[model samples]
Target chain A: MIYLTLFWTFAKVGLFTIGGGYAMIPLIQQQLIERHGWVTPEQFTDFVGIAESTPGPFAINIATFAGIHVAEQHGLSPLLGSVCSTGGVVLPSLVIILLIAGAFHYAMRHWAVRAALEGAKPVVVGLIGSAAFTLLGHTLLPAGEPFHWAAAGFAVALFALTHWVRIGAVSLILLGGALGLVLRCFGVSL
Target chain B: MGAGAEGQVSLGRRLWALTLTFGKFGGITFGGGYAIVALLEEELVRKKGWLTQDELFNIITIGESTPGPIAVNTATFVGYRLAGVLGGVVATAALVFPAWLVIVVVSGFYLAFRENTWVAAALAGIRVAAIVLIARAFLRMGQGVPRTAVNAAACALAFALVALLGCNALWVVVGGLLFGVLWHGVLPRLRGRRAEGGAR
Candidate 1:
């Protein structure tokens, strides 16, 4: 039952993950965090960080991690859970792509298909904006806790740096970890 | 079943080759889908001569516009084009395998050591960085959308509903698709019909 739930939940996430991997954030937050309470906001944030830092596609990494976490929480096998969730997420893509591959040219040229995608573009941006806003709030001010000045400062610095300098995602994440350890050396907990 | 330039290769050998190639891709690509795009262009298009540049671009367009992750879509498309249905399945599984294994190991460690003070502090910083990345993506993606009243409204409405009112995002996405069909598809045709009547 737990495996089935994980598969279904991630399948929905996969189905809605249009545009790219970042688009999955809002959906996962809704389904995993709000709907199932499988992981806390903090853990979800961690999952995003870990997913981004890890190799391979972001969608697969996050799904596998969430599946394992949920299964372990339920005293089930983490490996099977990961398989189910990961398979669930990939199944939609496999089926859809195969169906469309033969008729690839025509499918892309279809008017309704094009229009729907065109319309969904801005909404996807909005959804990504919402994810950023929610994560920013959670990071800067935890529930029932005082504002985290160190984190706020890091966020501002990192944001500015990204705008000014072209830093890749992996490097930025590594820099963040290094900075965190540096701060810890000074007895300052971020 | 036999098609494409590599038709001379045996079926079993070709499937194994797809597994190895996609497995290498899955293990190396960092960040997200776009990175994999560059890699595929370099390897399949330029190096292996498996796909032409035009085909790669078309695949990218289809990948982005379709539902689900772009990397997976690309993998499936390329896989099927090269081999068949079985090839598509094998390629996608190979692509996902390394990623799944890495995460499974990482998750175990993450859960075990997450409470350590050092790990907690590091995670705190990483969390902030992750938010920054997401915000950056929002800005970058927003710039791609054409500036229009309806679009602006859609963006703002989706944000408010999800971020403020705590509405379900899936429904919001569905609503966005419907709005697209209505505004871009049906509305234009209706306007054309009215204009034609006025001319008559």
Candidate 2:
């Protein structure tokens, strides 16, 4: 039942999300944290970090992580949970693409289809913005904890760094970890 | 259904080739969906000639517009084009395999070492970096959308609804689709009709 639940939940995520990996964040956050209680907000943030740094698509990495985490929590087989979750997420895309590969050209020609996609575009952007805002809030201020000055300052520095110089996601993440270790040496937790 | 340049290859060989190619893509792409797009262009279009430039563009367009991650959608498309339905499945699986494996191992370690001080510190920093990355994505994606009042309104409304009101994101997305149809599709048609009638 858990496997089925995991699969179905991810399938809905895959089918409903149109914009890409980042756009999937809010829905996943809601489903996993609020609705299912499968993952904590902190763990979800960690998953996002790992997913971003790791090779492969962000969607696949996060789904697999969530699956394994959920399965482990239930004392189920982690591999099986990952299989179910990953398979569920990929199934919709496979089916939809296969079904439409032939007719996609014709379908895309329709003004309604294009219009609908165009309309979804800005909304997708908003969704990503929402995700960033939510995650930022969670990172900077957790429940029953004092404001994290070190983390906030780090975030601001990184944000400013990105604007001033070109930095890749992986590099920025590595830099953060290194900087974190340095800060720890100085007895700063964040 | 059309047999393209790769039609001459045997099914088994083609499947193997797809596994290797997409597997590499799955292993190497670090950032997100768009990174894989560039990889596909270089490997499939330029080096391997599996897809033409025009076809690649079409795939990216379709990938973005369709549901799910753009990378997975593109893999499905490229695979299906090369070898048929079976090819599509193989390519998608291959592409997903590496990412899944890495996460499984990493998550195992992540949960186990989460209590460790050093790991926790690194994670704290990584978390902040992750937020910055998301914020950067937000800005980049925002730039792509045209500067129309309706688009600006939709973006703000979506943000407020999800971030402030705690509304379900799924419904907001659906609302966006409907809003698009009404604003872009229906309004234009009605305006065209009115203009034609006035001319008559």
Candidate 3:
């Protein structure tokens, strides 16, 4: 049943999300964190970093990793769980794209579909916006947990650095890990 | 008879090649679908000559406007164009397979020591950085959104609905779809009708 839930949850996300992986972050957070208690909000952030740092599609990585983590809680093997979740997520794309390819012109010309997407854009922005705020809340306000002010400040600095300096996302993530390790070595208590 | 047999052999070979090429792209490209597109052009158009530049561009345009992630959608289309349904399935699965394997391995290590305080402390910094990266995504996405009253209202409403009101995000998305139909679809037709009446 948990495996089935994992498949359906990602399948639904894969079906509806547009604009790709970043867009799917909030939905993943919603389904995996808010809806199910698979991982805490803070852990979800870590998973996001992991997903971006690793290769492949953003959503698929999240689905695969999150699926493995959640499935392990039920004493399931990570391998089978990952296959089920990844299969569920990719299934929609494989099926839907094939349908569109079959009737490419007609699908493209449909006005209601276009209008729905136009509507979805702003909503996606809001969803992403909410995700940003949610991440900030988790970082800044980890209730009953020690707030690592220094590390949090460093994160802000990195944000400014990346925006102004044009570093790639993968490099930035690597830099974050390196800095984290260095901070730990120096007894920074991050 | 020889020519027909030779053609069949090449089709099988092309499907295998398609699997390898898309699998490599899926394994390596880090950023997003657009990253895959640039690499696809280099490999399929410039290097392999599997597709012409114009054909790639048309596929890209279709891929972008479609619902699925651009990378997967493009793979499906290219594979289908090259062979058929079987080719499309093979290409899509190959593209996703490598990453799925990698994630499974990484997830094992992560879950094993998830409760370790040392790991948590070390990850604190990355967690902070992750927040920033997400913020960057938000700002980047915001730039593309049209600065219209309807859009702005929708953005604010959606934020409040999900973040403040704790409403289900899915419902917000559904509302946006309906709102879009009313705003972009129905409203325009109504205005045009009103304009025709005024002309009369």
Candidate 4:
């Protein structure tokens, strides 16, 4: 039963999560945490932390791990569990690719098609910008206080280090984590 | 027509070519889409000249708004633009097939070595890298923001509404849609009538 649910949910997520892992955060949060009750907010937060720390795309990793939770609850193996949910999320994008590939070549030379698409682009940009803002707003603040001043300060420093100092991102995350650890050790209440 | 300077290739051949192109990108390209933007812009736009910068930017934006992989969507759009449906299929398959394969392989090994200290250290390094990638995107988006006062205001408002107020993305998207249409379309129409009346 849970496997079935995992399959369907992931399939839905896979179909829609078009702009990559980050874009899927809202939907993933909705389906997995809010709707399903598969994991609590704290557990989901841990899931996200582990997912972020892993090697693959955040979307894929989360889907895989969460699928395991759903399937295993219903007595399924982790491997099968992972595959079932992954299949669901991937199927849409796969179909989209295959379906669109068949006709796009012929449509390339169509003037009206091109014009309509061109017109669409600015609108799409606006939408994307909107979505980006939505994600930033969610992640930027610490509940009500702009996501903790220390974290905010760390974010600023990371930005400066990356852009101005030309440091790599991996370095900044480590630095932030270390900073967080130090604060935690010092009982700074971060 | 411009079949890579080769003779007219079959649909199968074209699809194969696109698959190979994006599949390679999926497997080897790291640091995600924003990092690969320069690479992609170079390979697909500058060197290949498949899309103009504006067109590429449009695809990037659309991918951001939509669900799924930005690379995958861009590949679909570009491939579709180049060759139609076949191109879209080939490109998307190429892009994701690699990620899927890599994930499986990596996961198999990773699950087995869950306690490795080096793996932990490497992950620490990777975490930092990922954060940097996100930051890079922030800067890039900052650069792309329209310089107009209205556009600027909209950005700030959008930020505060979403960030400070915990506004949902769907709402922000709705707001942007309305804002774009009004600012770019309705406002111009209103101004056009005023100019015409003044002339009269």
Best TM-score among the predictions, by candidate number: 2
Q: Whole-model lDDT, candidate 3?
A: 0.72
* DockQ values, each candidate: 0.43, 0.45, 0.36, 0.19
Tens digit of lDDT per residue, candidate 1, span A66-184?
99989989999999999999989888878988998878657658777667666777776776678778767877788999998978888899989978997765566667778888899
Q: For residues A2-57, what per-residue lDDT tens digits would candidate 4 score against the true structure?
A: 77888888878877665556667678889987898777887677656555545434
Residue-wise C-alpha lDDT for candidate 1, range B1-200, written one tens digit per residue: 22455778877987898899899878766554655665565467646787765466456656766778888999999888887888889989999999998898778686555457786666666656656766776765667688999999999998899789977565676777778778998899899999999999
The numbered model that scores best in lDDT is 2
Per-residue accuracy of model 2 over A71-112 as CA lDDT, tens digit each: 999999999999999999899988999998967668878898
Q: Return the lDDT, model 1, position B171.
A: 69
**In terms of lDDT, which candidate is stronger, 1 or 3?**
1
lDDT value for model 1 = 0.79
TM-score of each prediction: 0.64, 0.66, 0.61, 0.61
Off by over 4 Å in 3: A1-89, A100-105, B1-99, B102-112, B115-122
lDDT of each: 0.79, 0.81, 0.72, 0.57
Which wins on TM-score, candidate 1 or candidate 3?
1
Greater lDDT among 2 and 4 belongs to 2
For residues B1-200, write the lDDT of model 4, one tens digit per residue: 24464345666776777777677666444433543444355466546566666656555644544556555567777777666766776776676555555445555454445455544444433333334444454445445555566666665675566545756444554456556556656666789999999999
| Candidate that beats the other on TM-score, 1 or 4, i.e. the better one | 1
Off by over 4 Å in 1: A1-89, A100-104, B1-95, B103-111
Question: If ranked by lDDT, best first, what sequence of candidates would result?
Answer: 2, 1, 3, 4
Arrange candidates by TM-score, highest first: which order? 2, 1, 4, 3
Distance from true position, residue A51, model 2, in Å? 9.6
